[model samples]
Target: MQFHLSFPISPLVPGIQHNQQLMLMGSCFAEEVGAQLTDHRFNTIINPNGILFNPLSITRALTSYLDGKLYTESDLFQHQDIWHSWQHHSRFSGLSKEAVLQQINQSQTTAIKAVEKLDWLIITLGSAHAYTLKENSQIVGNCHKVPASNFDKRLLTVEEIVTSLDNVMHRLFFRNRKVNILYTVSPVRYVRDGVVENNLSKAILLQAVHHLVNKFNRLYYFPAYELVIDDLRDYRFYKEDLVHPNEQAIQYVWEHVTKYCISPDSQELIKEIAEIRKAAAHKPFNPESEKHILFLKRYEDKVRKLMILYPQIDFQPLLLSFIR
Candidate 1:
């Protein structure tokens, strides 16, 4: 007997293959999926501007690259003896202004390079709520721990989100005509916003995605939000913070994403790569035992065979691990 309801998913006629390039942005959930794709040897660029939650910020990041925007010392501010940008995640913060701008410019350049060959672009919208800097009236991608009084908090209307998405799509296609776009609403709960507000925020994002999906022929929506709310409707699926989905819930959502979004041949290849990774990561109890050596030989053989079958799959890093 079926225990829980599953979200209805229509498979993309032919989903992403291993050889294609993927770019994912918006929210930490996008990072999680991108990490999985990377682990399986898919070429993917994830969150070049770091984890941007809202559509406006994500669009800003995309436009920054396409428009060739560069960061300068003026774009950064001293925060707790370090330099940081409101447009970037705190991970880019550094002790020197030159370092911060260097990193930010490097990331923007990397994104522009990646966009040229981008095959599938997946964007995850986490929230519709945004913070606008009071001084310049600019919506900051991140607040950078600035005082609350310096910013005006607001939730973007469905129209605004749709417009941001439309501009992003238009710019993306203008640069790359062959790219397929996918969008998803992150399942991470925004408890800090209060329950009702959080629901409203998510609803706005969902509505915007639906509108965009219907408008664009190549755009697709993945029901990651619905899977968490309807399928894994239990507190056990969340972390101690009761906000982010735990490993179990993420795995559940990932299975659905794989089934609906990955090509059949690539699915089998992912399985093989998973086995290779497991073998590579195995720790031997007897470091010099003959049996262990035999296992290593078999492991190397597996890697060799897999590489011969899929020449694009690189095993050099793992192979070099045994050299010294």
Candidate 2:
């Protein structure tokens, strides 16, 4: 007599939940999403290393992250001003350029340390095209004062992106085995780049990221592109420039991401944090305690640093006047 044996199917494993610490990088759009996560009380780090404006910058930052040499500056001038000048054509001469370069080098150590402890990494691909410097063949963040004759425009291919991402992933995994990756194609459009080339570039990135996610089990793709294009489906969701998504669009994207990735426990935690914030907002201020005085002093110090870094910023004068 032949006997048939019955076998039971294995239970489905639950999807990965998001109580883990998150680090975000890539384009400016990633910053928007990161801000929302922080506001919601998620353990999200925005550009903990620093903002990366091009592929070469990304490579350098990743190298620093692996080598444990990212930069950290209490002064905003050391961090933002130099980069802003380079982007805005405010730095035209050799002296100014050298200063910016030096600042970038100094920050490498702090950037590395910030990324070392991250459990999740989210990268947003903004553009496949970049401008490379003529002398050193390095990619520049923006085409500011660098003469038009001193640069070459190059559009990166799908293969190049995949290779770069693979290298980044390898480095992160080497440093820490448990790091997982999430990639999103930025929904922001390149309004200045001709329509055809712009669309073509975005399409290439979308396809490349999709392929990469499929190839690696630990790497995942969130459909920010679909949410903007298919779900929102309205031009009004964009900013005045018709390039970046408006606040409403960003809010929707953030909500969708947290709903899918965040754990139930984490959501509960966020709710508790929100209640605390609300209660704090309603409470009257008391200045008698030592702890309260110390907290106030620390906040004052932060404001002082901001004033020095951004002298022309309107709030600096306002804050100074208030303190005085």
Candidate 3:
């Protein structure tokens, strides 16, 4: 007898390679996958303008990168003595405007370069709901703890979402014709928007993504939302807030990603890297012991050997961690 519904995922053609430049954009779910790819030594950039939820905000951020837009004082606004960009996540907020602008501009520089050479672009849309400041009628990526009364909330239509994303794809393909896009609907639930409303929001995102994926040969969709909401279908997989996926749930999706999205030839390399990572994370019972010293030396030698074997990978961080 079967316990849960587990479906097969067809492997993506021309799957992700370790040497290729990849970018994971969109919600917090992107952050989770990006972190895993980073740990496995994949050359990847995650969320340049931070984690954007709706398609409009994501479109805005991507276009900014394509334009190499620079953030200035006029682009920023202060609330509670902290400066923030309506187009950026709270992570980019700073006490001083100069500090905030410096970080934002630096991210834009890196993001534009990343976009130009991007081999794979992974986008995870979180929701269709968007907030626009009532005063200026401008859509915001984040509220930055602003009063809800100051903004008007609306759920984006499927056509609107598709049009927004279509514009992004047109510009992106023009700059990097070789780029392949993978779309995923984030599984994180926004209960603040009401349960029925959240479902409706996700449905809109899914419809828009599939519509675009069908229209573009290089576009693909991953059933991340279905994997969590339908396959797992358990409360235990959720965090305390019942909104985010817990560690186990994230690992489950990541396992599927490795099996379907990444190149099979790189599996052995991933396993070897995981082992080295685990060894690096080990905490010794006796830090001064000869056995611990030998343990460190062994991993250091392993790192050096691996580095020689895969010259494209940067193992300096792991090597340094093993060194001392």
Candidate 4:
């Protein structure tokens, strides 16, 4: 009784344990998956340059770290009483240029360090559509609410997308030869670009990812786009805006990721940690009841024993919570 087709994911590398470091880039979906990885206490960092979608923008951010480029006053433009860089997400903008540079530079320092030790680099491509600011003819990561007339919007060709990913792969392989790469196309619809354009953009991204995966032996695709659009093809799977995957859809895709990508040992520990997480978040009606206190003590013991087994997992917060 197969109601839906499932994507065949590649075998996860043998050494990908909970303690292994991972670097996540591209799209909000990357952030979504990274959040769960972080929740389970996987050593992971998400979109150090923020949620960039287009391939060129993501590569630019990665390469910037390699080149040791930090945003300066010259790189920022004063707009609406704030300083913003076209290379960064709007969240990084600040009232003062120095403040923005401080945040951006700090994050780059962290990302550069993370990149040096990454065991896995997960990339979730969102779209092939890119916007180059007409003023400088540069591929800007975000427009920061500037008028559309100020930017030239264009769809990236398959070759163009491949070149960007190729650059990323070359840099990563040069720096960290042991890092395995996982590529996924985000299922989030770009309805703002029109439905036809959205599909065309995804087609390009799909082709580009396929080309890169074929070119590099350590690279693989997870079929996250197929998971939502094909496996759970229902309007109910979408959020109210009909653009993003709802909780159920996200969970389904994450479950597939766990089954296919995460190691069995880490998966088992994640289940145990989920229970401990559940108990940690639980709040009793009686704030100081003996029953609640005893429950907290049991959770504390459970955490200490598990921490002894897997020292990588963070049991500090739960310990402090129970203590408080």
Leading candidate by lDDT: 3
TM-score, cand. 4: 0.96
User: Positional deviation of 243 in candidate 2, in angstroms?
Assistant: 1.0
TM-score of every model versus the real structure: 0.96, 0.69, 0.98, 0.96
Q: 271, model 4: CA deviation in Å?
A: 0.5
Q: Where is the poorest 10-residue window by lDDT in model 1?
A: 315-324
lDDT of 4: 0.88
lDDT of each: 0.88, 0.63, 0.93, 0.88
Residue-level lDDT tens digits of model 2 in 1-324: 734322222211232334456777777788898886776545666764344544445555566567765232321122233443322122321344456455554454445665667678888877888787688686665565445798888888888877887887787777777777888878888867777888888888888788888898678778887788777878899999888899999988876775666666555545544543443343336656676656545545654564465443223432332232
Candidate 3 lDDT: 0.93
- Regions more than 4 Å wrong, model 4: none
Lowest lDDT 10-residue stretch of candidate 2: 5-14
Judge candidate 4 at residue 234 and give its lDDT: 94
Q: Give the Å error, residue 158, model 3.
A: 0.4
Q: Which stretches of candidate 3 lie over 4 Å from their true place?
A: none
Tens digit per residue, CA lDDT, model 3, 1-324: 999898877789988989899999999999999999999999988998899999999999999989988888999999999999999999999998999999999988999888989999999999899999999989999999999999999999999999989998999999998999999999999999999999999999999999999999999988889999999999999999999999999999998888889898777789889999999999999988999999999999999999998899999999998886
